[model samples]
Every structure is written in C-alpha cells, then in structure tokens.
Target: MVVGGDAAKEYVAGFAAGVATVIVGHPFDTIKVKLQTHNTKTQVKEYKNAIHCTSQILRSEGVKGLYRGASSSFIGMAFESSLIFGIYSQAKQLLQGETESIKPQLQVIIPSAAFGGALISFILCPAELVKCRMQVQGRDSANSNYVRYAGPLDCALNTMKSEGVKGIFRGGFTTLLRESIGNATFFSTYEMSRHYMHLQLNSNSSARSQQSKILSDVGIGIISGGLAGMAFWTAVLPLDVAKTLIQTAPDPNSSRDPFRTLGSIYSRVGLKGCYAGLGPTLARAFPANAVAIVTWEGAAKLLGVKRD
Candidate 1:
C-alpha cells in the first residue's frame, strides 16, 4: 500500500526522515564536502582518504568536530527533504494513473521531480550555507583571518552578529540552482530506474508472486536513489563549487567580493576544480539515499498508503 495524504503529512514524514538521516549522516557529509572543496594550493592535504580524513578530524577536533553543524544540517535537511518529497509525491500522483502497473514513459515523471527539486532549494540554502562554513572552518582557520565557529549555533550567531540575517542566507541563489537542478536529475533518474526494474521483474517467468513486487520496489528505490545522488552531484558540481567558495570566502572587510572569489576559482581550477568534491559526494549519496528510500517506503506502509 502506498501512502496517501495532502501535502502536510508527506512534508512531515520527509522532514522527519531527513532529520534522522542528517543526524546519522552529516558528519560524513561534512567530511565529504570538506574534502570535495579542499583548496589544495593553500590547505595542506592532511589525511590520505575519507577514513583518514575522518580520523584526523576526530583526533584534532574531538568527536564534536565530526558532528559540526549537526543542528543546522538537521534543520536544513528537514526542510529540503520535506519539500522535495512532498512535491514529488504530490506531483507523482497528479502525473500518473492510480494503477499497479508501472508507467511506460519515464519522461513523464521528470517534470514533477524537477519542480520538487526547485522548491526545496529555497528551504535548503541557509542551512547549507551554515553547513559549508562548519565543514570548511578547519581549513579556513589555517589561512584566513576568520575566527573559527565552534558549531552551527556559533556560526549562526557570528553571522548574525556581523552580517545580520542576510548573512545567514548569502548563497541562497547558488543553493537553489544546485538543489533544483540536481534533484530534477535525481528524481528523473530514480523513476526511470524503478520503471526499468519493474519491467524486468514482470518479464521474469519464475518471479515470486507475493513478494516480487515489494522486493522490486525496494531494490529499485535503492538503486534509483543512489543513481540520483550520483547524477545530482555530477550535474551541479559547479554550483556546489561556487557555493563552497561563497560560504568560505572571507568577509567583505577582508576586501574580497564573493563573485570575484568564485571567478578566481573558475579561472584557476577550471572545470576539473569545479568537480573537486565528486568522489566523497558519490560515496555518501548511495547509503544515505538508500536509507531515505527505505524509511519513506516503510513509513508509507506503516501509515497504510496503498501502492499502485
């Protein structure tokens, strides 16, 4: 059975699941982003791999360092995921017939997912700004005059104290671009994968009758979500690179325009630099999205949502 409701329940469940995923996953996420956006020219490459980076952060900064910006990450993820899932679910229902059979054209699902992706970027920008700051603070402190933020609250308070509320949302436009485009690709990819999986299962002569569909959905969801995550990072690599630059770029008092800073990055690194963080981003996306799909499906079932 698939879940049914107006937008409210979908949003709430998405928010809850997103929050849970962030709390469990943000530490790795932070590390991943930091590695992805690391300034090799300036910052010394400390750890060899992701595991090494994690251990180094923990050793130097303590466990808290691993969980830096966890609070803001949760808040940002809650809003972003809630909005994305809500819009996706509602859009899916609107686009397709309420039938058990998979739809033939995967293209029909893309617009709905794209719309959801665009909408959630608004909710995600500020929190993502803070998250980027926290992730890069260790490196920032090494070269810049910026005082290190202890955690999400510290980052927020400092930004508000110095730059006001606007400071907190500085890179919202870039975030919107990244999330919206990324999610459109993500959802479209996921739906297509799911459809393909369903088709394969249906064609199998010895497929189990009672559990085949359920297993297929679960398998498809996992693969699709992971693929979507991969597609998202690949498509939005430049935006993410720009976002990191804007977030970590020194304040105006330091006499650097954020735009110019980003331009400098582009000039120096070119396309390759823009994709600096793809490796870890891809690593984290698979399990994180797998968990998200499982949770969403489980919740829908628990709530008696009738699946077609």
Candidate 2:
C-alpha cells in the first residue's frame, strides 16, 4: 500500500518538518552563505574554513550569529515545506491513481517532487533574499558605521524600499532551478533508500504489530532521510553556492543569472569556488533532514494521517 495522507495533513506535517530543519540546520546554513559570499575577487576572504568560520562567529558574535536570519527562514521554510510536501503528496497520489504498488516509481516521484519544488521557489526566493542579506551582514567589522537590520521584517522593508519589489525576488530563477533539481534528487533518494531498507528489514513487515511496524519505519526513515539530505547537497552544492553569491552580492546591479555567475566564479576561482561551503553544508545535511523527516512522521501520526 502506498503511504500518504490528505493534502492538509501533509501540509501540517511539513510545517513541523520545516521548523525542525531551521533549528538543526540554520547554523550550518549561515556558515555556508558566508563562505559562498566572502571568497570573491572583490572581497577579502573572512573565513579559511568551516571551523574558522564557526570559531569566528562564536568569538565575535556569539551563538546568535550562527542564527542570524533564522526568523525569516522559520517563516519561509514553514510555508515552503508545507506547500512542497502537500503538493508532492497530492501530485504523487494523482499520478499513482489506482495503482496498488507500494514501491514508488521514479517516473511518478521525480516529476511530482520537482513540481512541488518549482512551485515553492516563488515563496522561497524573497525569504531567502532577505535571509542571505542578513546572514552576510556584520562581516565588515572595520566599518563601524555599517547598520545591521533590526530583524527579518526590517530587512524586508529596507530591501523593498531600496530595490523595489524586484529586489525581494533577486535570485528567483536560481532558487527555482535549485529547488526543482535538488528536491527531485532528494525525494528520489529517500524513497529508493526506504524501499531498499524495508525489503531488507522485513520479509513480513505487514504481519508485525502496529508498534513494531512504527518503530521499524522510524528507524528506516531516519537513515533514509539522512542519506537523502546528504545526497541533495552533493547534487546541488555548486548551484547553491551560485545562488548565495547572486543573492548576497553587495552590488544590486550585479548579474543575477546563476549559470553565468557560476561561469564567472569558475573562471575566477575554478571548481573550488563553485563548491564553496561544501564542508558545513554536508555536515548540516544529515542531522537536519533526519530530524525533519522524523518530526514530519511524528506529526502525521499525531494528526491521524494514515500510512501503509
């Protein structure tokens, strides 16, 4: 039997997932954005590596620095995850139709996941734009006059007033590309891993008691989700690096085309430049997404969403 629930249930579960994500992942995300934006021709590299970055943030700005733009991310990710999970569930259900197979087909899963990702990009872009800008601020310690945003809302208002509505969506296309491709890889890997683990663990899982089955599912979900999270960053860190650069550029008039910007980065600094922040990103991926999936599953269960 296919595992799923009504769209509303998935949305609620996904909100829980998103919240878990930000809490576990935001510190790593801050390091990733800072790494991506700082190592450029025009700017002096502020961090030698993820360790250096973490230490610097700790010493200078305290733990709060690592969560600079978390408020915006919390809001954005809650809505984004809700929509992405809801759309993915609904689309997969629609695509599967009357099919009775418990095993997920890539043909159905990839497109469904990608479609959800593409749709959520619209919501993600502005929130990320604000988040990136906030994350990258305070780097210029020498400039005593640099004014930081009071908060997420203040940052958004300032961006809108200065760059207009378009400014809020500065790196939208990059966000779209990243989400669509990354999510396709993400969900596909999770489903495939889950299926493999299910087969290996139980020749007769269905015969197990409800509690045993739930426990098995939770264990499998945690591993699969972690692997899936790692897979996502491995597939798209270069694109993510490009997205960060585009969103956090000091010059508003800078090129916004992600591919072209990536090309520029490649020309200037080669492959390493395109893959900036790989360390913290991969480190953050496994635990963050594992928690997200666990939370999601727990929420779904609490809400009485049905499963296999």
lDDT of each: 0.70, 0.87
Residue 170, model 2: lDDT of 91
How many angstroms is residue 113 displaced in model 1 relative to the true structure, after the best TM-score fit? 2.4
After superposition, the stretches of candidate 1 with alpha carbons farther than 4 Å from their true spots are 1-6, 40-52, 95-108, 139-144, 205-213, 253-263
TM-score of every model versus the real structure: 0.84, 0.94
- lDDT, model 1, position 278: 65
Judge candidate 2 against the unseen true structure and give its global Cα lDDT, from 0 to 1: 0.87
lDDT of 1 at 277: 61
Task: Encode model 1's per-residue lDDT on 1-308: one tens digit a residue.
Answer: 12455457676667766866786577777776676556433434544567778787887788888777778887888778778887888887777645544453455467777788777776677788788787777734777544688677888788888888777777777777777678778777776776777678778856576686677668877787778677777788767777776766566343224355556766775655566666667777777887776666666566555555
lDDT: which candidate is best? Answer: 2
